[model samples]
Target: MKKLVLTGAAGRLGSYLREPLSQMCDRLVSTDWTEDIGKLYPSETYVKADLGDLEAMEAVLDGADMVVHFGAIGDEAAWDKILHSNIIGAYNVWEAAARKGLRRVVYASSIHAVGMYPKTQRIDTEVPHRPDTYYGLAKCFAEDLGSLYWDKKGIESVHLRILSAAQVNNPRALGSWLSYDDLIHLVQQAITTPITGFCVIYGVSNNDRVTVDNHKAAFLGYRPKDNAEQCAEEVLAAADPADPHDPGQMCQGGPFASVEIGFSGTASMNIVQDKKEI
Candidate 1:
């Protein structure tokens, strides 16, 4: 590819992606609201821009072949904050991609989009959106926005409804863990696939207790290598008895399902700040 744009360049997942994406394109343009993202790859350049600014998004996406959108608050937040950063930010990215003639958008969606579903039900990409929080609602909006753009503007998109792309320290993570290696593989497939008009796939690993099915997305060739079972013994050994009545324990969204609309879900998840420093 000639040029590829990556939003949320300062984020944890985005940090891991910068080097790899730089290798895939002749020029990798990374953008974030931060002033700088430290050292860049040989083919990478940093663009300090906010996702809420349509003009900035347009300037950042100009001439890019595709975009890997990961910008936004990754946790449940107040409605106003979610509105500006996640909802409006998404519009700017998609609108800019269409106006710039980008080929596709590999969006970083979330499991919260269907967070209300019971963990017992093995859901798929086609399930209706049942957002658990304002953050999840934003994801639902972006997924629909992507669909609308494909139907109306011929812009292609692949929404990866990511589960838990973090360390597996809890029982719920055993079924939702998506290792960083698998994340890169999924993004690569979403970007290189030949004829994906608008697709949705779970960003999860090949865990023994995996909850979501990805058979419909087999064409994308996303064969996840890592599994959370390796940590099952330790996690289960220290696991607390799950209350069947708690939505956090019974629903696919875990803590997000139980958190208040404006509360932070990641705060209770004990997520490590393991950003890949380049």
Candidate 2:
């Protein structure tokens, strides 16, 4: 690829993606609301922009091969906050990418888009969305937006319903964790696949205890090498036994499913706040 664009370049996941993406493409334009993302990688340039801003997005997207859109409020937040950053921001990215004639958009959608589904059911990519929070709802909106664009504008997209892409710190993570290496591999698959009209792939690993099924998306060739199974014994030992009656523990969304809508789930979530700047 000649040029690639990445939103949320300052985020934890983006921190890991910067170098690899730069290596794959001739030029990588990394953008975020921040003034800087610390240091730049080879073939990577920084641009300050917001996903909610159409003009800025258009300018950054010009001449790009594909866009890795991870720029959003990563956690559950107020309705207005989710609206501006998640909902509107997603639209701007798609609109800008389509206008620029980009081949595809690899979106950072969350598993929360199907969080309300029970983990016991073992759902696949074809299942209808059942968002558990405003944040999850935004993912659904973006995925639908990607589909609409593909159907109407002939623009293609790949929605990665990421389960967990951070350190495996809790019991729930054993089934949902996605290693950084696996994430980079997933993006590469999304961008290099010969033809993907509009696809949805779960961003997860080969964990032995997984609840979400990825059999339908196997064609993307995202064979994850890393697995959360290694940490299962340790994590499960320290974690409290899951209550079947508890909606949060029983559902695919975990804590997000039990929390009230428009409320913060970060405090309850066992997420690693990786602060190191790339």
Candidate 3:
């Protein structure tokens, strides 16, 4: 790849991706709303850009072969905030990618897009959207927008519905955890795949108790190697038994399923700090 653009470059996940992404392309443009990204790779360039601005996104996407869109508010907040960052920002990305003639967009969608489904039901890539928050609703909209752009404008996209890309500290994480190594592999597959019109795949490790199915998206070649089961005994021991009637515990999205519209579900979980070499 000649040029690759990564949004939300200052974020926790982006910190791990920057160096590897820089290696994949001749030039890697890392952007975020923040002014500083601390340390930079030799081939990596930093830029401050907001997802809400179409012209800014267009400029950043120019000459890029592909885009890894992880920029957003990342939580269930006010509708106004979600509208600008997640919803409008997503449209801007697709439109910009279409105008710039980029090959593909790898979006950071969340499992919250289908959060309302019962945990007992093994959801698949093709399952209908059951968003739990305004944040999740935005993801669903962007996914549909990706599909529209593909059908109408020929832009390719891969929407990865990540379950839990954090430490396996809770019972739900035993099935939902997505190791950082697997995350890098998943993104590589999405970018290198020969053809991906509009694909949706669950971003998860090969756990013993996985609740999501990726059989339909076999073409993307994302085979996760890590298993959260290694930490299952400790996590399960720490977890309190779920009430059968509570949507939060019984649903696939876990805490997100029961949180109020503007509350932060991630705050309730103890996520391990990411340690990346600067």
Per-residue alpha-carbon lDDT of model 3 for 131-214, expressed as tens digits?
999999999999999999999999899999999988888888889999999999998899899999999999999999999999
What's the lDDT for residue 48 in model 1?
94
Model 2 alpha-carbon drift over 4 Å, by segment:
275-277
lDDT of 1 by residue, 151-171 (tens): 999999999999999989899
What are the lDDT scores of the predictions, listed in order? 0.95, 0.92, 0.92
> Which portions of model 1 show Cα errors greater than 4 Å?
none
- Which is the leading candidate under lDDT? 1
The superposed Cα distance between candidate 1 and the true structure at residue 245, in angstroms, equals 0.6
| Clash pairs for candidate 3 | none
Error of 3 at 131 (Å): 0.3
RMSD list, candidates in order: 0.6, 1.0, 0.9
TM-score ranking from best to worst?
A: 1, 3, 2
lDDT of 1 at 239: 89
- Clash number by candidate, in order: 0, 0, 0
